[model samples]
Target: MSRAKSPFSPAAVLRGALVPMLVVALWQGLSMSGLINPVVLPSPVAVVERWWAYLLPPDPYDPAQGSWFLWALSGEMLFDAWSSLYRVVLGFAVGAGLALPLGLAMGGKPRIYALMDPLLQILRPIPPIAYIPLAILWFGLGNAPAVFLIAIGAFFPVLMNTIAGVRHVDGIYLRAARNLGVGRTTMFIRVILPAATPYILAGARIGIGTAFIVVIVSEMIAVNSGLGFRILEAREFMWSDKIIAGMFTIGLLGLAIDIGMNRLNNHLLRWHRGLEN
Candidate 1:
């Protein structure tokens, strides 16, 4: 039998688009009415025009800054984006890599839990921003500091979720695995990890978001160049539209990364679909 169409089908695209369209319409209306200052809140059309200008060359006054339209396509932009992205990936990886094993050990053994649980509890509540000063002092103002901040930001979700997942594993499954002559290591890999995959994926998703937050904040403070720096520069020069454009770009990229991660999680956890259904 075929399933019914989901409410969130392609038509939902139009439905979703409506809110932003209304917002833009209202904004344009306000601009025309002169109720809003164009300096602070440019019209939707103006923002679009500026965005287009940034994405394509206008009449060149000087050939250098004239290429502002090509900024998004430039090697510098790509490199900066990549540098920020790399920090996130590396930090998330480090956090997850360390957290998984540590969480497993803590959850799987009471002795380890007794020793480590208190520490994790204490540390987990500290905001990633709190670590920035120390991170800067320890790693200096470069990728190291940025990645360190990202790692700190990403660590807690993975650690906490993994511990929760491992703690809640079905005892019957553990018994069955042991009854089948599975070693502890084999049971963990074949049973616990698979069972914990959902929570792990959830943690990773949160971690990725945290990574982006850390990247932007870290870039703002401790880096010379990145989207954050570009935005700051635009603000300093009072290029309000460019600043707005940069913010939009950051939002779009962050959203794309999140959506991509969600898709990957769905693909990897297909088995969980049966249980949910």
Candidate 2:
């Protein structure tokens, strides 16, 4: 008869914040003690100040700036955030869209799986970073190359998990559906898909994170208008504060995306939870 604690409860929030706060305190103490070089590792307070400025900088409006793309790259935090988010979303969509169907086919049919698995295994071991050079060469220096890298990073996890999910659908459910006179298509749509949804969602969470990592790395080389690009630009100028701030921004964005995905999973998997309970 014990009650479940809400994740958003004050105690839960405090518990989550505790470790980060402690780390920040230790960082500040080290900075004050002159144990860490400010140029190399700016204090938490300095990072925060820089982040505040980056979040709310003076308008760099100039009619001569001409293109909207150039205006966005003019040290605007929101634009950088939006740019990164856009790439992640587009890339993830492309990756998951292709992966889900192919995975379904591969999982459901041994012949297809046998045909495709070897090539995939070979490709999967190679890191997505390895594709960056070719992606840039093919797509040139815009969102396309970054999106391509992110998609590659996202694709394998989702494909593998989806295949596993479909393959591992409960035998009981399959037998029940067959006994109930369900057609192949009907059985797959109604029984297999519902049962496999949880695993597919798990893959999606992992895939989204992979997309974020790839997009950032790709932006550092492929593009010039994301948080990743900003971080690199800051490094070139030796603006350690801005670098730290950009890093924090990326972390926060990733965290927000993770939380959103978790919420989606919870909402979608309510039936699975009930079955387990």
Candidate 3:
């Protein structure tokens, strides 16, 4: 018998942190020794200082300069993050809400699947970035274009995954439901949906990642306020530390979202012990 893996074990946690800790130490040493130009590759300390400045008031004695606008940086960070979050959630909800039912119908009905599969196949290959110009022209920039781009990015993943899930459900389950005199609506609600939960959540996880990616790209070109826009703006000012800080912010937020989603998926799918592992 094979032993199960526990990824959250103490050994695993230490092993994961070791590399990053070493890297941070190496980075600090290099900057202090002047082996690397701070402008070119800002130290880990510098990046944290810049990030801290963004989240809190800057002291006059701080080397970065300026007394700061009370809560300007934090406000911008929160506002931009909120703006991106709103667009992604709204678009994702819209896309998945529509895709789930359609996907279920398609999987349950071969006639519908045959009719729709070809079209989906053709459209699915088209990248979301390709639609940016048209989105701008049609939606005219700002939140509308951003949301549209995110929706396009997220739609197909959920649709395909949901269809796969429903279609792959065990035949015995369907027969058992019918044999039990379960009504069509009750069958779908109690049996089909629950059976397909794994696949749907898988799709949702993929869709949210795509949504975040598209929202970032959309913000860079179509909107003025977001982590993406902030990164580009920092580049224009040649603020390397600030730019790196912004990148870290985006990465941390993405990681947090992914972790939260994973936890939720695990909680809901506790019966599927393999997934939790």
Winner by lDDT: 2
Ranking by TM-score: 2, 3, 1
Q: Write candidate 1's Cα lDDT for 1-277 as tens digits.
A: 3554665788877788899999889888988899877878877777777766655533444556656546535544455566677778898898888888888887788899999988878988898989999988998888888888888888889888888888889899999989999998999899998888888888889988998998888888888777777677777877777778778878877988888997898788987855332
- Give the per-residue lDDT digits (tens) of candidate 2, residues 69-112: 66655557887998999999999999999999999889999999
Clashing residue pairs in candidate 2 are none
What lDDT score is found at residue 150 in candidate 1? Answer: 89
**lDDT agreement of model 2 with the native:** 0.90
Q: How high is the CA lDDT of each candidate model?
A: 0.81, 0.90, 0.86
TM-score of 1: 0.86
User: Model 3 — TM-score against the truth?
Assistant: 0.87
Which parts of model 2 have CA positions greater than 4 angstroms off? 1-18, 60-75, 274-277
Note the residue pairs that clash in candidate 3: none
* Candidate 3 per-residue C-alpha lDDT over 126-228 given as tens digits, one digit per residue, 9 for 90 to 100: 9999999999999997889888888888898999999999988898999999999999899888999889999999999999999999988998998898888
Greater-TM-score candidate between 1 and 2? 2
Pairs in steric clash, model 1: 54-69
C-alpha-based local distance difference test score of model 3: 0.86
Stretches of model 1 off by over 4 angstroms after superposition: 1-11, 56-72, 75-80, 274-277
